[model samples]
Target: MNESYKIISSSILFWFSQKKWFVYSILISIFLLNLNTPLGLTVPAYHSLIILLLVFMLVTFEPIPFPAIALLTLVLQVVLGVAPPNVVASSFMNDAVLFVMGSLMFAIAIVHQGLDIRLAKLIIKIFGKSKRMFLAGLMTISAVLSSFLGEHTVIAIMLPIGLSVIKNIDTQQADGKNAVLLTLFSIAYGTIIGSIGTPSGGARNVIMINYLQEFSNVSIDYWKWMKHAYPILMIQLVVAYFVLQFTFPSSLNNIKMRGFKKNVVKIDVKKNINHLFSCLIIIGIVSSWFAFNDIYGLGIIALAGALTFMIFGMISWEEINKNTNWGVILLFAATISLGFQINETGASSWLVLKFNELLATFPSNSMDVSWSIMAVLSGLTANFFTSSATVSLIGPLAIELHPTDISFALSSAIASGFSFLTVISSPTAMIIYSTGLVSTKIFFKVGILMFCISIIILYLMSQFYWVML
Candidate 1:
């Protein structure tokens, strides 16, 4: 009997230990729900904020699976009277969510066609003569591809290339190790900087676009987004190239080309036809996004791309389904729904009021001061939380901050791409860390430098450059 009691006690303790955050979140929610609603905020708005807090905890600690958290977010909206069932359901799925789904499917189709290998070989052909040129070429190509293909997709493709280059190098020596680190970081950072170049580059950009249209009635098409953002991407690529060089000083001037050559398969015409066709489909889709996105919407156009890929037998539905992270899609939809409710219930405006009050104490309402605060907060939050989540939560508040100045919205979205501070911050960072060769200490050190520089660049652009546009 005593043994049985100890076993049961131990099992209970283990469960508590594993689910402590979950328990804490629920307890806090209950406590907050019982408290009097704050001044200047409606009950529903206050409750929505409470749900938002719960989501941050659950997402950060991850004591529950993402699907469960997603379901809870939806359920809380209806149960806590945050929104009606129909309203919640409608907001749960929209163009922003559709864009995310379509992009993920498109990425799967693009990656499965082995185009990444072709692109990797192309990089070698162009930049193999010099180490600096090779790194710059790798980063530049990665940025351009990820600008349209999405950062995670580009990273998946480029990581192997980066790895193959450093595989034969003797890492026991300092220069060799630095060479490896530099190559891997170049690919990761390239994808990151590139993710802000176009609307489809990252889900966060789409979320911001969606909020802008929904709340502010402002429409920014694909090309317009690229116009506002591509210059920043170009400048960031140059800065990041130098940052990586300085952060990881390495001399691979005498490295051979055999490693890259060995990794790339010989191209045959018959086989290469499929590659060419795949490229055409991507081009068609991007063109559609540029031309008809205002009419058909980015989501439908993106989905059409995936549909075309399937029709041509480039990839199977089973493969796309298996590869997609449905939970993330669901969670994103929930956060977006919550964002709508926050705006609908005036929580976002309330936030803007408080934010402005905080800034009012500073004596200067210059664009730089206000813009810097939003950028820093957005960047720091993005580095800790996922970028999409940061935008879903923060986008509405940003738009409300300066209803006339779209630069606030644009800068907030752009700054969220500064995901250099942590491994879990972005998929590119996580992919590099998964190799187990990168030191967290070194990664953090470089990330801090990059984050600060990125903020400065963004501030300058917003003040001098973005105004021109």
Candidate 2:
């Protein structure tokens, strides 16, 4: 009887410990809900703020799965009388959410086609001779591929290749450790730097585009976005190469890569036809996005690409369903809805007003200063939370601050992709850290340097390049 009582008591204690953060989040939200704001916020606006804070904590701490948090967020809105059922349901779907879903599907199709093997052969062919040139080549390939294929996909493809290279290294030598670190970081930093190049590169870009359109009615097409962001991407890639080289300098001049054959394998006629068709389909979809995004929208074009692959028998639904991260999509949708609420309920405006008052004490209150401040803050916040979450939380205020200037909003969103401080900052970072070769100290040492460089470059682009455009 006593043992049975202990088991019951332990089970209860375990449950409470597991759910303590959830309880705290609920209690804090309730307390804030009851309070009156001096900023003249409406009850719904205050409720939105409470929800935002709760979600921010939950997402950061991850007390439960993110998808569950997203669903709970929607449920709590109705249960707490924050919004109606129809309104909450409507918020769950949007062009941005569809774009993310379709993009993931398309990415899965591309990966399933085994293009990474072809890419690896090409990379080995190009930069297999010299160590320095190989490092540069890896970074260049990673960045360029990530710009089009998305950072996560590029990282997923490149990580194994990097690890293979590290595994072949002689760790007994003194310079061996540095070589391994350099190789891994080359892929990581490249993927990160390139994610800012285009909308397809990262989810944050899509979320920002949607927010800009919904809130400010500013429409930026695919080519236009690439035109604005690609230059910054190019410069950052060069900077990243230098940064990695300087931080983790390798004394080895050349690496003898084993297990990589120089001879090309001849493909069968049927496989060749499929490869050609897949390439053509990808080109067609991307070209359409560039040429006709204003007419059909990016989301539709992306979905069309995935459908094309499925119809052609190049990919299967099972592959996409198993590989896709629906939780991220749900989290993104929830945050976007909350962002809209922040705008509609005047919470964003109030927060912007408070920020403006704080800025009034500064020596200069110019738009440039405002843009710089927002970019830095967003960049810093992104290193802790996901970039999508940072953008969703800060985007409303950015738009409210410069309601007419789309440049400010675009710059802030792009800058937030500079997640260089921690392994958890971005998936690319996490992937690199998984190799177990990169110590946190080395990651931070290199990351802090790159972060400083990125901020400076972003600030300069905002002032000079964006002004001309």
Candidate 3:
């Protein structure tokens, strides 16, 4: 018996050293802590935050897999007794999560039709034989396409094209491969820049919007989202371009471009005109969302436009299905449910109370102090949790701390989007890590630098663009 105990203790210690072990530990801890506590809706909310942090910590920074983290979360949630089977089960069916699924299907349609490739070729033709012009065109196209279709779809549709462009580098140069890497940076950064501009741009943005409306009362519709997001996106893109260009100048030396040898196929006339119709659909959806619905509920309009797309045969079910990432959807659902448990158990409230008490020692202006802490902590927390879960858990608390400075809270929320210390910080970090292009240390070095720059820029942007002068 003593030997068995020794072996089990060693195994538990070993598990913590591994990635998913700590995650499961936290999940179980939350459940056990809340099992007897009088937590309300907040119980699940706490679980959400804790679980998200663990999952991202593993996915981006550790070699542990995403699906495995998710499975561990599920099992721990069950064994710890934080929630009943039905409540845990229902998290999988959120409307916001479903919309994401539907959008994916729509995105796949565009890819399936060979429309994305044809469009890239058109872009290649437009840049007028200049490599710089061609790179700019790719960024522009990626941004526009990602805003409606979602970032993953945009990345999937365009990544190969970017690589192909790299392959096409003129053979006359000895280091043609280096030339492509520079252009690829443009593609990667531009895709990241565009991803924040719209709901469909990324999963977390949509999830954040839904949580904003559902939990808080801040309603930013499609048009309103564009109002603030477009400005940030444009600046971010230009900055990203200059940063990459300066940071990796060797990546762009002129070369004899190669490989786009296939004859350019013009999109059929019917689909050519379909672009105009798609434009109308986009415009109408934005206008209608603003004109109709309460501030907290504009998603129905996105759903409506999606329906229009389907009914009109602009994109088919198969296309949408192909684009959706059910794994991500499931992950979001599970985390949100956990967040609910956190809230209900009063764990979040208790944590906030303790934090606020600690903040009483700071002599600075409460608003400034609160926002500054939020900006930093949100980023740190996100290394362990997702941005959406970060927002869901901390956003409301930030607002509560400084209700008059709602913009400050918003700044913190946006700042939380920067998570870079660990690979699990954000979706982009996670997805890109999956591609195996760079090492963990490479990710850490670049990610930390970007995180620092983002903090400064995010603070300045919040002040200049959205907050007080």
| lDDT score of residue 27 within candidate 1 | 100
Residue runs of model 1 more than 4 Å from their true location after superposition:
1-4, 266-270
Clashes of 2: 0
Candidate 2 — what's its lDDT?
A: 0.81
Candidate 2 lDDT over residue span 211-325, tens digit each: 8988889988777788889999899989998887787778853244433333335667877687778788888887887887778777788889999999988888888889989
Steric collisions counted per model:
0, 0, 42
Which tens-of-lDDT digit does each residue in 1-469 have in candidate 3? 9999999999987876674555665566556555553434355545545554555455445445555655666765666566777767775456566555555554554455455555666777787387777777777777776665566567776776666656545635535634655566566556666766766565556555655555556765666666666677776667666665555555455533334434345557886677767657766765564576344334455567677878888877665665566666566666655655555455656667767878788887755566678788877776677666566556556555554544655565556655555656655455556655434665566567666777777666676777432
- By TM-score: ranked, best first: 1, 2, 3
Q: Which ten residues in a row have the lowest lDDT in candidate 3?
A: 255-264
TM-score of each: 0.97, 0.94, 0.75
Candidate 1 overall lDDT versus native = 0.89
Q: Which is the better candidate, 2 or 3, if ranked by lDDT? A: 2
Please give the RMSD of candidate 1 to the true structure: 1.4
C-alpha positional error of residue 173 in candidate 3 after TM-score superposition, expressed in Å: 9.5
Best prediction by TM-score: 1
